[model samples]
Target: MSTSEPVPDPSAVAAHSAPDAPRAHAGSAATPALRVRTLRLEDEIDLPAHLPRDLTAAWLRHGQGMVGIGTAWTCTTSGPDRFEDASARFRELAAAARIDDEVGTRGSGLIAFGSFSYSASSPRPSTLLVPRAILGVLDNDPFLTLVDVLDEQEDAPDAAGAAPTDWRDLFPSTPRAERTRVQIDPDHTPDEYQELVRRALGMIEEGRAQKIVLSESSTVHLEQAQPVATLLSRLAESYPTTWVYHLSDVIGATPEMLADTEHGRLFSRVLAGSRPVAEGSELAEQDRRAFRSDAKELAEHAFAIDSVTSRLADLTTEITASAEPFVLRLPGLEHLASDVAGELREGVTSLDVAGRLHPSAAVSGTPREAADAAIAELEVRDRGGYASPVGWMDAEGDGQWAIALRMAHLETPTRVRVQSGGGLVAGSDPVLEHAEALAKSRPVLRAIGRPED
Candidate 1:
């Protein structure tokens, strides 16, 4: 997407409005470029705290990542080819860009923060957005990058000359959230969801699929609209280790990485199998041990790992995976977790790898095609953006994308939909699966300031 209109002055950090249209192509100008200028900052930034209240986009994890305001351009598409469409559009923008990067790091120039829906059939279009101004921190160093699209008539500005001495002054004011209460309503009743899991197990037994992931959502109705920044800040504070993201209407703190590609390296974290970790340390450790040894959980986790590696094998070299999954502890549960790494092929972008890795046995089921069919037949409610990829990719096609887990969709000012699910195998227990889904929902629920029921 490109625009011929003159971009706002780089010195102005105030929020600006983006076009409402889906695609903004560079008009048939003789020359058009996506111009990016990076200015390294002198001080360290305290994330979530330093994040502005009205952030348009963000991808933060472990106190690093970027927060952006306003939209410079957008590449939005729907249906099965969404990933390809967005990737091609971004590649064009990046290929023709003019960049001055003093920082010259992974995320230093021309970044598009993206969030894709879980299903291609979803009416909600997946988005790749380029924010007008960005403040980011990577490798413990902070920097500011001003992004714009320039037509043949405009001249690219100098980075150092336009940068402010005090980068802090660029930020807008943040306001506190009003204490709010929410009305929660599950999409499927406990019994209904249990029946769904039972049906999935039946399908597995009948040889339709080896495993199927079933999810449930609860609509959170607020008395009044709550600021998304407040919820983002709360999630970041509580789950600092998870990727805290807010792109358009989707917001979450996800622990599972769908893909993280930098230079030629590809890294992914696959999570499956779960045990709710309540209060007692001894009990939690016991649960962790039992979880590690449980045949059902181990089998479920194995399916997830294989799903990732098999796909990586096609796009990467020297692929490596953990021999055994480690216990990944979170606020309310522990997951069987494994890390997979590889070197990407010459032309594979992060999105390409993500499209292939998504709906892995971790999220879908083994025998992907069969599992997805079962999900369509059995699942009454749509998954929306849950279990999908959400993150940013720089102009270099190097970026991070995480499964949109532990997340909620702000459907409106007052209504947020929170979702969670678990993998189901032939011997899975419906009641236990329902409990596990609830356990997975805790982080977002707690972040919303509500105790889990």
Candidate 2:
């Protein structure tokens, strides 16, 4: 890695340029008001298994989290102003929305699930979606919340028509039996991916950037349209440690938490170096020890650590980071991981923290702009939502946001793109880096039933 000067703190930098005023979306002025009602359920329910095929949004880990059904309101924005524009509009709506809570829990009241693109220039619009109904299990308490958008006269519908009285009515009666076979094909030749890695190494050699992350995608061709809920249930069951997420067509289990704000506290988990673990190897300690001592991996990890702490220091108080990184073992891979936390400064929303900490050295390279420029030039593909912040935030400005990793995007009924990438330093081997990307992709591949890679 280059011994170049460290990148400036992201908080010190100007926020992404946004319109002077928030632009309206479907849930904005179009609907005069939104009425939200939360009710506790008598029986506990499995969160992912109940996710419906259409208009579903979820963020779950260890079988506990929120699942949103049907869109009550949604906002889409693009360009540099995407985050700011969406955040402003959400704050406005949440502040105005009405709520009647019979079950007071973390995810109750008005909540919006969101996914942002990795780059401002991406053609895909970043989105924030408020579900018409929410099925959630936090701290083992099963509950449901319904949101009803009021018409122009600002009058809510009749009580019977406004919200479902029984939580059982909200869940699907039976699992869909429909299934489809999937074929995983490389979107780009291995040689092409290696060339991109070589170019990134050249940039590092020339001191253009310290470390750059390069990613590639694979096309998962399905024989026919498959139910997303089934695929998500598989992922949740297989990778209980990861946050299995679904926002629109985007679905995956991410191991990295970009930012999680709750009850006046902020927390984050950063992951960088990675190595594949044999599926059922009993002696994985050897690989774990080797990964820990590797100088290149340590260097890559340090950059990610500094990037997070610096940005967090600006938005939080009493900030502290993990003393040493620990190996986080997953289904087919393990990563060097560290946790950072602090007490939130007043009025600093989770989205605000995400904006400052995003493009962290783990995803983008050190000296953020240079690495971003390198990614744009070398990859030559719009990273629609890969490596971006994908999670949900509540009306209270407290929410969990995870880096969109180990994910696949369903482009259409028959086409899905599974993507993965790794960090590259001065001595990064193109061949090895390419292999690492494939290793990182194992989780999603295994989830979709193609474990033999």
Clashing residue pairs for model 2 = none
TM-score of each: 0.90, 0.90
* lDDT: worst 10-residue window of model 1: 5-14
Residues 1-453 of candidate 2 have per-residue lDDT tens digits of: 001110111110011221111112333344335788888887868776676654357788999898776556677777777777788878877877888988888888888898899998887778887777788999998888887766535375423223675765666632454445668888678998998899899999999999999998898876655566667777888899999998855889999999999988988999989886677542267767888888999999999999999988878887888998998888777889999988999998899889888889999998899999998888756888899999999988889999999998867756778899999998888988898899888777666654233
**Model 2 scores what on Cα lDDT?**
0.78
Give residue 420's lDDT in candidate 1 (0 to 100). 88
- C-alpha lDDT values of all predictions: 0.78, 0.78
